[model samples]
Target chain A: MLKINDLHASVEDKAILRGINLHVKPGEVHAIMGPNGSGKSTLASVVAGKEEYEVQSGEILLDGENIDELSAEERAHKGVFLSFQYPVEIPGVSVTNFMKTAINETRKAQGLKEMPANEMLKMIRQKSELLEIDRKFLSRSLNEGFSGGEKKRNEIFQMAMLEPKLAILDETDSGLDIDALRIVANGVNKLKSEDNAVIVITHYQRLLDYIVPDFVHVLYEGRIVKSGTKELAHELEAKGYDWIKEEVGV
Target chain B: MSKYTEDDLREELKTKEYEYGFYTDIESETFPVGLNEDIVRAISKKKEEPEWMTEWRLEAFRSWQEMIEPEWANVHYEKPDFQAISYYSAPNSKPKYDSLDEVDPELLATFEKLGISLDEQKKLAGVAMDVVVDSVSVATTFKKTLAEKGIIFCSISEAIQEHPELVKKYIGTVVPQKDNFYAALNSAVFSDGSFCYIPKGVRCPMELSTYFRINQAGTGQFERTLVIADEGSYVSYLEGCTAPSRDENQLHAAVVELIALDDAEIKYSTVQNWFPGDADGKGGVFNFVTKRGLCEKNAKISWTQVETGSAVTWKYPSCVLKGDNSVGEFYSIAVTNNYQQADTGTKMVHLGNNTKSTIISKGISAGKSQNSYRGLVQVSSRAENARNFSQCDSLLMGNLCGAHTFPYIEANNKTAKIEHEATTSKIGEDQIFYCNQRGIDTEKAIALIVNGFSKEVLNKLPMEFAVEAQKLLEISLEGSVG
Candidate 1:
């Protein structure tokens, strides 16, 4: 569903992703694990077409179309989604209104009319139910004063609303407790299907136990240095990333 | 992708044109350019005012001659040449229109172009409109409906002729002749504005609105609005203005006064959209207005204004709580873009015991404009237990713009409780990216962010006016970001 060839990206003359490559097919769950500052979030942001990060010498493709020239919003219209590591706080916009605007705008970009108000409400209710979000929480300002777990869950709620084909959960498990992690992982697992894909990026292996990935890749420095199955997560959790660093002689 | 820097946003903001820049070709009988005692007398004579009114104008003119233009505002502008502007200009035909068909077609077209057709306003919005062109009120709608409820609504000139007792008792009672430099000038040579009076124990059936337009090129617009809510009465008044694009700065110095008698309530709102000149700041309106209200015992007064135009603006709508347990409120959203400068806020004076006041100000500055909020809260020694809360927030769109706050508080009463809070924030790139990633464009994202920032103040507006104000904010900031 998504392809990245020789992905070299930087921000303000500082290279972050150097010659990284990744490919993910539909219906497959891919886990990209790494220590701090290993370009995990940068890869997600680049795929989402963040303007600050310049694609120095690489290309990203979604559904066999070169999306390097598309804007972040255009990419979103074409079914690309990125769950931000830290959600922004918009003080006066309710989560429902924000979702409505996002959904309507994406529909508008595709030459469709705005979603019917009743249908939008129904979808919101269904998604919030799927994610176990409070009804009152949808009316509060977007992410303003939200707890860390609530923010992460809200990001997942948005992913469910957009129903993007390629969803990149960048550090979604960072601030979640055990219960919250189970709920978030359960929500992601239910939304999985054959026509879409999920890429989970995390620093720890605790989340893999809930939303068990089919493939695990360890990203060190700027590139993925090792690839294995679900058992590799338990292996790394028992040991540590130091063994991988030694194996890569870094 | 190409880099969309702040410089690019600044360039885009500069390219936006003022939408209401079209001039109407109407023949007008314009007074010669100059201001003196004789000119003030001539204006009073043109209105055929009573002898006392003429003497009042002369007194104001005398005070104005002695008063120099104040320069204390946080604004920089080439001082307007007062003598170079025509003091009065009215359309040639002065016949009173009995109905819409009797009005001038060209004049109706002007209102239509302004998106305020009198016929539509009367039929649809149920709003009584006093349409003022140049310095003369051309049409006053829904007068009979308002008069049915003992609500006196008409032009100031009509009110002076027909209801002199009410006009004489309240005119200049709140903002006197020597209130300030602009107030003195406006009091001296003001031509026309709306005057509304809600009778005792009566509520106005509909919104009282006045739409001021400056069509003549060189004439200065000086309008004086007076609203009086008698004992146990209630009223809501709205005022809006716009001017044609010109190469020289035109002057718009207006004075508004409100009186809320014992147990009465008054709500006054202004959506000022005067011409804001071109991108280079060549010409626009010099808006220096004085608006103040007086609240009697147990009375309440509220002022809500959304200001988005003018090259240079200096306005402060204030309330004086004179009676015990009275309330005052001020809610404002001021937007400036592309060389526009606005210094606007409100003043709350707690002279009565146990009185309260609240102020919410939102200023949005884009392009190279400068926006400032200057407010004052004063609690007198006799005002025991007076309380006031104020919040001033500013949002800047680009690096070249500026926002400033000047808050003054004076509490003499030991029991007074006053609190003030302020914040200044820029539209962060992360916020924009978040919206963009959700499929919203840059322009739509800016509109969303700004409307969010201004939701508090916008909520205070009347439902219809709130929608228009929101649209105005979006239009004012169009192309302000990539």
Candidate 2:
């Protein structure tokens, strides 16, 4: 469902993703584990089409179509979603209004009519209940004055609302408590299907316990140095990233 | 003095007409373009004012001649050649309008172009309008309905004729003729604007509005509006203005004075969309207006404005808190695009003890235009326990535009608590990308963010005008963002 070939990206002339090659098929969960400066978040941002990252040379394909030249909004219309590490706080913009605009915009781009307000509200209610988010939370400004855990949960709530084809969770468990993390993982796990995929980018393997991945890739210096099964997450969690660094010889 | 014997030398001359040289052929009576003692006398004589009123006009004219144009605003334009412009241009039509059916079609057509149908304006449930076409008030709707509640709504000229005592007493009390240059100019040669008086203990049943349109070329619009809310009375007044597109800069110097007596409340709102100059800045309206309100003991006054158009706008709607426990507020969203320049804000003067004031200003600048918010908050020594809060925010659409904020706070009373906050920021690419990533396009994203930036001020607008203001903001910022 997704492919990245020799993805070389930089910001302000400083290369962040030197050479990255990865692929994921449908119905599979892939976890990328790395240290703080291993370009894990940069990889997610590049895939989401952030303008600040300069793609010196690369090709990103989603469902066999080149997406590197597409705009962020166009990519979003193609069912690409990014769960931000720090959600932006848009003041005075109600969550329901923001979500409706986003949902309708995506649907319109996909050649569908706008959803009725009542139906949208009903859908939001059902999703809120499923995600355990309070109904009043949808009326408040998006992420304004929300707690750290609430922000992460809101990110997951948005993911559920958009129902993107490829969901990239960038450190979604960083600020979440264990229970919040479990709830977030549960929400992601519920949305998984045979035609969609999930890429969980994290520094800790604790989140891997809730949403187990089919494959684990150890990223070191912007390159995927090793790949294995779910046991690789446990091995890294026990011995830390030093083992990978020693094995890769810098 | 020409050539030889039967030859004569003739020099052909052309008048430097208005840069906005559009003319509508409506039969009108106009005073010649010049200013002197006789012109003031003629204006007073034409209105058939009392002796004291004539003396007042003369005093204002003399004071105006002595004072020079103010250079304090952040606008740059040649001083208007006041002596070379006509101050009064009234339609030559008769003043006998027994009913709405007797109104002139030409005047009605002008209103039609302004999108104001007289019938629709009359049928609007809670709105009363006084239409000022050119230099005179043509018709005032809902006068009888308003009069039943002891609320007096009429033209300033009619008020001078019917309610002369009230007009003579409080006409210039709030905004004295010598208050400023434009005020003095308006005082010297002011034409007709609306006059609204809410009686004591009466809450006005409807929103009082006045529409001022300038249709004649080479004519300066000097409208003087006075709204007084008596003790315990409440009123909301709205003013909207527009002008035909012109290349010669048309001069518009208006003075609006609002007075709120003890325990009274007054809310004044304006949606000004005067013709901004062409994209090349060839011509537009030069709006130098003076609007001020005075709040007596326990009275409150609020000024809300959505300014979208004007070539060079220089105005500050202010308030004077003279009564104890009085409150003043100003909420504004001033946008300038395509060579439009505006230097506008508000001032609050706390003169009585325990007075309070709040100011929120949002300025959006685009397309090499310059927008500024200049305000002042002053607390006199007698105003103990005075409080004030001011927030001014500016959003720049491009690198070429400019946004500036200048706030001056003067506190002679040690007990006064005043706080001022301002921020200037350009719409960053990251913020835009975030919105775009959500499937919202660039234009809608810009509108959403701009709306959010001005939400604080927009919330203060009246319900009907809020939607209009939002649409205006969106249209004004078109082609602003890349």
Candidate 3:
């Protein structure tokens, strides 16, 4: 579903991701875990085509097509979604209206008619129910004064609405409590399909417990140091990232 | 339901022509450059004003000659060459027309393009419209219906002729002739505007409105609007303006005065879309207006405005709470894009006991424009228990634009309760990316963000004009700096 070869990215003059090569086939869930200063989040951001980051030397292919030149919005129209850790607070724009704009814009880009109002409403109702989001919550201003859990849940709600082919959950679990984590994890699990993929980037293996991954890669010093199956997450959770840092030997 | 492609929309936005840019091809009786008592007398005589009206205009002309233009606003522009602008220009046609069909084809076409044709407006049910072209009113609709209800709605010129007593008693009563330099000039040589009067205990069943169109090349448009809500009456008046595209800046100095007598209520709304100059800030309207309302015992006055046009806008619609338990409110959203500049707000003067006032102002600055909100809230010594609440928020779209606020509050009565809150926010790149990541383009995202930022003030507009104001905000900031 997604392929990155020698992904060397930098923001400003500082190199973040030195050399990253990763491949995720369809229906695969990959978890990338690293300590605070590692390039885990940077990898997610680079793949999503954030313009601030310079892809110094990299090739990102989506379905075998080079997407390096695509804009963030274009990437989104091509079924790439990023669930921001900190969703923007757009006061006075209701969540429903924001989603409407997003949906219509994507449909417009794909040369499709706008979803009928009733269908959109029904979709919102069914999807929001999947996340246990109150109906009134959908009418409030988009993330303005929303609690941290609500913001993360809203991010997942948007992810559900867009139903992207490749979803990047960048630190989506950092601000969630136990119940919110369960709800968000459940929502993502229900949306997973053989034709879709999710790249989970987290500091701790805590989120991996709720949304188990098919594979785990230990990222340290801007490169993947180890790759293993789901037990690697349990091992990292039991021990710590210190073992990997020591193994990399600075 | 939609046929436009994104390319077509982009092409249309690229042209960005002033939608109301067509100039009427009519022979106009215009005055030559210069100003004096003779010019004022000529304008008054042209309107066939009553003797008292003529005398008041002469007095204003004398006062204007002695007044120096104030320079305290936060806008930068070359001072206009007042001596070079024609003080009066009116279409060479008769005053009264029986129906919209009788109006000149060219003049009617102008309104049609503006989407406010008399027939369309009459179909709007309860809106009485006075269409002012250049410096004279060419169409007045729903006058008969309004008159039958003891409501006076007509051109100021016609009001001076038919309801001279009301005009004489109310003109300059709220915003006096010498209130400011522009007000003095408008009082002196003002040509025509809408005049509305609601009789005692009578609630006007319609929205009294006027559409001022500046068509001539170099003629200045001086309009005077007066609305009076007599004792225990209620009225809501709305006015909007547009000007033909001109390379050289045109001057528009208008004065609006409103009076709400005892137990009366008056609501005034304005959607000002004067021609903002070209991208380089070459030609546009220099809009300098003075608007104020006087509230009597237990009366209420509210001013709601959406200012999205003009090369340079300097207007402060204010309220004077003069009687016990009176109230005042100001809700505004001012947008300045390109090289446009605006320094507008309101003044609430509390002179009566327990008088209350509320102010909400939102300013959006894009491109290299500058937007400022300058307001004053004053509580006099005897205004015990007077209360005022003010909120002013500014949203900056690009790094190049500027937003400023200057709120002056003076409380002489120790018992007065005054509170103010203000915030300045930037349209962060992350915010834009958030929308982009959701598949919305930059243009549509910006329009959504801006509309959201000003929703509070936009909500205060009349039902029909809110949609127009929202569109104006988008068009004004279409191709912004960022």
Candidate 4:
């Protein structure tokens, strides 16, 4: 569903991702693991078409089409979703209204009529039930004064509403407790199908315990040093990233 | 989600055009650009006012000549040439129309373009209206229904000729002739405005509204609105205005006063959408007006205004809480776009025991415009246990626009409790990105964010006006951000 080759990205003249490469196929989960500042989140951001990062030399493809020229919103309209690390707080726009606008806008971009009000409400009800979100919470302003877990859950809730083909979970599990982690991972696991995929970017293996990955790539110094099976995650958990840093020789 | 650039969106909005710029082909009697005692006398004579009214206008004219225009507001614009503006202009037709059918067809067409068609306005049936074209009232609707309830609703000119006793007792009582430069000018040569009076111990059964439009090219609009809620009475009054598009700047200086007697309550709202010049601010309305209200014992008064259209605006609607246990409220949302400049706020004076007041002001500045909220909350010594809470927030759309808050508070009572809070924020790229990531484009994102920012104040407007105000905010902020 997604492909990145020779991905060299930087922000403000400082190189972050140097010659990184990854291929995400449908019905499969890819876990990218790296220590702090090792360009793990940067990779997720680049894949989602964040404007801050400059692609010094790289190309990205979505479903075999070059997406390097697409804007963040256009990428989203083409079924790319990024769960932000720190969601913004819009004080007076309720979560429900925000979701309605997002859903309708995406539909509009695809040349579809607006969803009927009753169907929209039913969809909201079913999705909120799947995510264990309160109706009252859905009426509150988007992420304003929301707890860390609530923010992550709301992000996932939006992801569920959009049903993007390629979902990049960028540090979505760091701020969540074990219960919220279970709920979030459960939501992702349920939504996974043969036509969609997810890339979980995290520093630890905690989230992997809930949603096991098909492959694990250990990244060191902005390059994927090792690619292996799920056993590599437990191995990395046993030996910290320092061991990997030594293996890569700085 | 439009694929257009911010500049494209701005162009689309500019094409929205000053919808009221269309002129009506009608003969008008106009005065030359100058103000003197003779001009004031001529206006009064044209209205056929009684002797006392003419003398009072002359006195106001003398006071206006001695007063200097204020320059303390946080706005910069070329001072208007008052001597070059026609003081009075009226459609050379009958002053009063017995029915909507008798009104000029072109004048009625103007109202239709403004979205308050005369037929629809009358069909609403729940609202009584005083429709003023240029400087004279052409029709006062639902007079018979209002009069049956001992409620007097008519043009100020008709009020003077019919109910001289009440008009004399209230005119210039709340906002005096020498109160301010613009107020004095309005009092001197003001042509026509709405006058509403509710009897003692009666609640007005329907809404009373006045629509003011400036049709002639060079004439300014100076209307006076007075609303009196007698003892234990209640009323809600609404005023809205528009002006035709012109390259030459027009001036709108008016006075509005309200009086609430013991146990009475008055609520006044204004949706001012005068022409807000072209993108370069070549020409538009310069709105300088004074509005004030007085509350007697156990009375309450509230002012709610949504100001979105004016090249330059200087207005402050205030309240004087003179009655014990009286309440005062000011809820406003002022939007300035392109080169428009607005300096608006409210003043609350708590002079009676146990009085209270609340102020919520929201200012949105976009497109190199400047918007400011200057408010004052004063508590006198006799105002024991007086309380006031004020919240002023500003939202900036781009780096070039500006938003300022100047709050002045005076407390002399030992038991007075006052709280003031303010915040200023910008539309950050991150917020826009968040929305974009959810599939909303920058233009819709900005509109959503702005509407959210101004929701608190917009919620206070009447339903019909609230929707219109919300749409206005969206249009004003378009292309403000890229």
Task: Provide the TM-score of chain A alone for each candidate, in the order shown.
Answer: 0.98, 0.98, 0.98, 0.98
lDDT (Cα, tens digit) per residue for candidate 4, span B283-320 = 98999989999999999999999898989999999999
The candidate maximizing DockQ is 1
| Predicted complex 1: DockQ | 0.83
- Candidate 3 per-residue lDDT, tens place, B295-410, comes to 99999999999998899999999999999999999999998877899999999999999999999999988777899999999999999999999999999875667999999999
Q: What does candidate 1's lDDT look like per residue over B18-39, in tens digits?
A: 8888888888999999898888
Tens digits of lDDT, candidate 4, A1-250: 7988898989889998888888889999999898889898888877777788888787899999988888788899999999998999997899998999999999999999998999999999999998888889999999999999999999999999999999999888988999989999998888889999999888889999988999999877678888887888998999988888888888
| Candidate 3 per-residue lDDT over residues A1-250, each given as its tens digit | 7999988989887999988989998899999988887888788878877767888897999999998888788899999999887789999999999999999999999999999999999999999998888999999999999998999999999999999999999999988898888888898899999999998988778788888899999888788889998899988988898988788887
Q: Give the Cα lDDT of each candidate.
A: 0.91, 0.86, 0.88, 0.87
Per model, state how many residue pairs clash.
Answer: 0, 6, 0, 0
Model 2: per-residue Cα lDDT at residue B473: 79
Q: Which candidate gets the maximum lDDT versus the true structure?
A: 1
Q: Please compute DockQ, using alpha carbons, for every candidate against the native two-chain complex.
A: 0.83, 0.24, 0.45, 0.52
Give the CA lDDT, 0 to 100, for residue B24 in model 4: 79
- Here the TM-score of candidate 1's chain B is 0.98
Interface RMSD per candidate? 0.9, 18.4, 7.2, 3.6
Worst 10 residues of 3 chain B by lDDT: B1-10
Candidate 2's residue-wise lDDT over A1-250, tens digit each? Answer: 8999999999889999988999999999999998989999999989998877888898899999999888788899999999888888776688887888899989998999999989998889888999889998888887889988888888888888998899999999998899989999998898899989999999899999999999999888989999999999999999999989999998
